[model samples]
Target: MGRYTMKSVSLNRLPIGSGLPKICIPIVAHTQEEVMKTAVQVVRSPADLVEWRLDFFDSLSPETVLETATELRQMLHGLPLLATFRSHREGGQQQTDDSAGIRIYHCLMDRQLAEAVDLELSQPADIRRSILSLARQTDTKVVMSYHDFRRTPSQKTIEGILGKMAAEQADIAKIAVMPQTPADVLRLLSATVSARSRLNIPVVTMAMGPLGKLSRISGSLTGSAITFGILDHASAPGQIEAGLLKNFLDELTVDQ
Candidate 1:
């Protein structure tokens, strides 16, 4: 619905960035049992995709993670899965070394456990490139992301970050920042609109916290290809329930 020059990526035949923004739900649980339970709920929710916050897992071992992911893949009944290992610095629950995290990513992509993977842009350039290479070889979509939990940067800064992600050859670019004021939320949306118009790849941007909740449901107008919604728990601040968020997106799309 966004009036932007962009390319769309297919996840199980669902074309992101081609029409209404797709809704994604996050599954954050510590144990496999809890994870499966959450997955069941996500399957019933009005979500176009599901993101597994690997950092929330009690075990980060490659074998355990792969086994768990395999089970989750089957549980979703073909829902697109996005594997994310958010660093603690990026508001993730767990802290992991870059080497170990990359290993886990390799496992996921090699086996095609997830359709898309999120790599932090803040990671070393070489590390990111290596992951991008593997992702390409495995036909996995790479979503390069950056997060600022403190404050929303100037619109120029936000746009620059998104540009960097595109230059990195990301299939998708995402940024999440905390807004200290209503004006900060506007700054975030302004940046999203600019990046969405200029970038060839899809972009996802949002301002976190109560003051920034409006941006979550404003993707259609701002050119964001995807919006994160909550299923059992919210991985980020200001995430509304998946069903409610779907209703909001539908209404907004209709009005537009």
Candidate 2:
């Protein structure tokens, strides 16, 4: 368990940010068959949640997005689904116009397909506010996220971003930064601890790539509620296999 007492979010009766950090596996397949196959593997794994990275799909129309989401919901067998359309600027597979991306998000919210949706903190204020409002109205959880592929910022700057996400009324505040040095990873973890102590919402923080794998596994001790793991394929760098990641988390939690 973490040192700080923070509010928790329930996903299909699973409590995130309460005890051990939950693993979220991203389904980054290009075709429906591939997605289905990977989801089957994820259901058998120890992952706690599934994140659908829509940008990896070859077709991303509102119709197709909804169709895929609906199928995945059924296929996941009650697992929490996190819908993510990462923008190209933030290390996504493809580039999509802001307007089109917002439209797809609205469709997901209105249809009530995903239990949670990821909205980038770098989006325009108006756009972010609009999506947040829709999420509230639909009773969908918003995972407000920030990604810095270049390098991790100072601890204060990372904490400031988490504060802003909390101010936006997001259910979860997530920050994933690339770390160049050991100190950078430490800064990310420090920010996570600080934010969780001060903010009411759950914080999901990770230091991406090989240099920061330690941060991913130690999140439960530092106040991060969730961590991404690789299922069939990896959507981001430095993700451990789901089974291995779960064992690591279990061991750490038991030791604590």
Number of the predicted model whose lDDT against the real structure is largest: 1
User: In candidate 1, where is summed lDDT lowest over 10 consecutive residues?
Assistant: 1-10
lDDT per model, in order? 0.89, 0.88
lDDT of 1 by residue, 128-216 (tens): 99999999999999999999999999999999999999998999999999999899999999999889888889999888888988999
RMSD to truth, every model: 1.5, 1.5
**Model 2 quality (TM-score):** 0.96
Clashes per candidate (backbone, < 3 Å):
0, 0
- Candidate 2, RMSD to the unseen true structure: 1.5
TM-score per candidate, chains pooled: 0.96, 0.96
Error of 2 at 159 (Å): 0.4
Q: Candidate 2, which segments miss by more than 4 Å at Cα?
A: 1-5, 254-256
